[model samples]
Target: MAYQVIIIEDDPMVAAIDRQYVETDSRFQVAHVLKSGGEALGVLENCRPDLIILDFYTPSMDGMEFVDRLHAMGQYPAIIMVTSANDREIVHGLLSRGVLDYLVKPFAFARFRQAMDKFLQTQNLLSCSQESSLLDQQAIDRLIRRQERPEPGGNQMSKGLNAATLERVRSFLSASRGQALTSEEIAEQVHLSRITIRRYVNYMVETGELASSIDYHTGGRPSIRYSYTGQTAEP
Candidate 1:
């Protein structure tokens, strides 16, 4: 079953965008879109969502008050803050209260995707711990290290290249197998901007994770197509 998510943003447009980003990953579903924390609190017990995308400022109740109320009610859903508020005090307070991730307003889709990936990773680790009843040192370390870390590619990724986004592109190309696709095509499939997709594809090609070829059938300047190389880069 897909994990349920609730979005709490007073702005309708931002709420729609949050829903779009959340639904891009097949593993999650938006369970509710509420305008304020007061409305959210009304349904939290019944909905019991796994995650929430929240804005700091709202009409009835602010983000901090919402969090405090949740704690008082003994409900602790994972939260990813997406708001214009960048005050250091607000951020520090939310972090101390265990918000899973924070994104300032005007953030890119890649950054949003990264936050969702982190939440999923944490959920997976928690599930494993529940089944085993005991976690090894490595497992504990992974849970504690919430910050983004380079994966698959042992070296740090280049600027603007996110590991989660790169993996999404790689996964799509790998599934395509025999067919190679241009950046635009891949972007459409993966719900990422073409330029972002192109950057990742180029990085993957350099790392030997993808192979590229020129396609001249368009009757204009030849376009480059990428395919998974069937080889994993050595760390």
Candidate 2:
């Protein structure tokens, strides 16, 4: 069965992009696209989706308030924030409130796909029997924990790099958070050669998974630093 999704974004273009990105995965479908949190609340009177692609700033009531009301009414579905807001407090608060994932604006298709893939994995585990074995419980626990820590490996593979190793490099940078890392630094952590790491880094930079910056010094050649941007590459 396809996962039902509701999108609450004020911008029509962004909403359309969100819908398009999710539709690329056959496992998901958008059931409704409302312009504001208020409209979404009204629509929920008749429909309930498996997930909600929400923006932080919406008309009537913003995304945070909408979530507050949802919790007050005891309605919780997996939520992934697709907004331009980058305040650290807001991100931390949403995570604390059990939001599934957060995607900033101008994100690549892969980032959106990453969140949907996670939701699918969680849904699969949840579809199992409630009285399942201890092993099943352990697996679910691990999956939940994986969300808090970025683990490398995605379905998307670029040339000369497999998904597994690509993710390993990604995971290393993600673990570092906003810290600026170079190809040499990442190579050491992922245990790959600099040349190989550079290729992967270049690919990620192009794909929007990572952001690169140039560092100039007094006496040495300029160095490049890469940071995980929490966004995906273009489709």
Candidate 3:
């Protein structure tokens, strides 16, 4: 089950690097490398790769516009936005447009591998369904599409935390190391609801894994803030 990949980037040099990465993985094949949205539209209808690596900045039409056009043509290749834009708005924009996930630019090889592996995990679950294999929906859903599962050797599951929640919490904590982030800030960073984040934070604090403090510096009354203690074992 080799998945074909298409790279659409304006930068030829960067596109070549992405091609190299795709080729290194046995499960993925670089199907095409195109520059602009127009060029992509030219052959995409014919190429129909399993996944598309899109760049945000491109000449002519941009990635989002091209994705819109692609969907209009009844095409839905799993999209992963690979760009230098680390802005939360950009990440939310892609998610709002139904992108599978996104990867920020200047990523290390390990991070790149993580992104690709997560896509493959989702593909694995879908392939099983296509094969007519009977699967428990909850179990499969829990196991499927885990884009950030921690290394199992850590054994942090004993605290009753699964990979999804653990990864979400970890990323939030990592991004909030220097400053205390409000519940809303944590939610936005983790792409979870503020209520849901509170629940997770409460759990971690109850387990003595996270630290929370009262903040009055931002005005509008004082509010509680949550952050990881940086002492919890990475699981």
Q: Which stretches of candidate 2 lie over 4 Å from their true place?
A: 130-137, 147-235
**TM-score comparison, 2 vs 3, better candidate:** 2
lDDT of each: 0.81, 0.77, 0.71
Indicate which candidate wins on lDDT: 1
Candidate 2 versus the native: TM-score?
A: 0.61
In order of appearance, the predictions have TM-scores of 0.67, 0.61, 0.60
| Clashing residue pairs found in predicted model 3 | none
lDDT of 2: 0.77
Better of 1 and 2 by lDDT: 1
Return the TM-score for candidate 3, rounded to 2 decimals.
0.60
85-176 in candidate 1: lDDT tens per residue? 99999999999999999999987655676798789888878777666788898878988896453466566474456878878888888899
* Model 2 lDDT per residue over 1-235, tens place: 8889999998876776677566545567789999999998888877778999999988898778889888776789999999998899888878888899999987765566567767877776666566854446577686767553133554445244777888888788888987988778888888898777876776676567887665545255446678898887544
Instruction: Highest TM-score: give the candidate number.
Output: 1
Which pairs of residues clash in candidate 2, taking residues 3 or more apart in a chain or in different chains? 108-232, 152-167, 153-167, 207-233
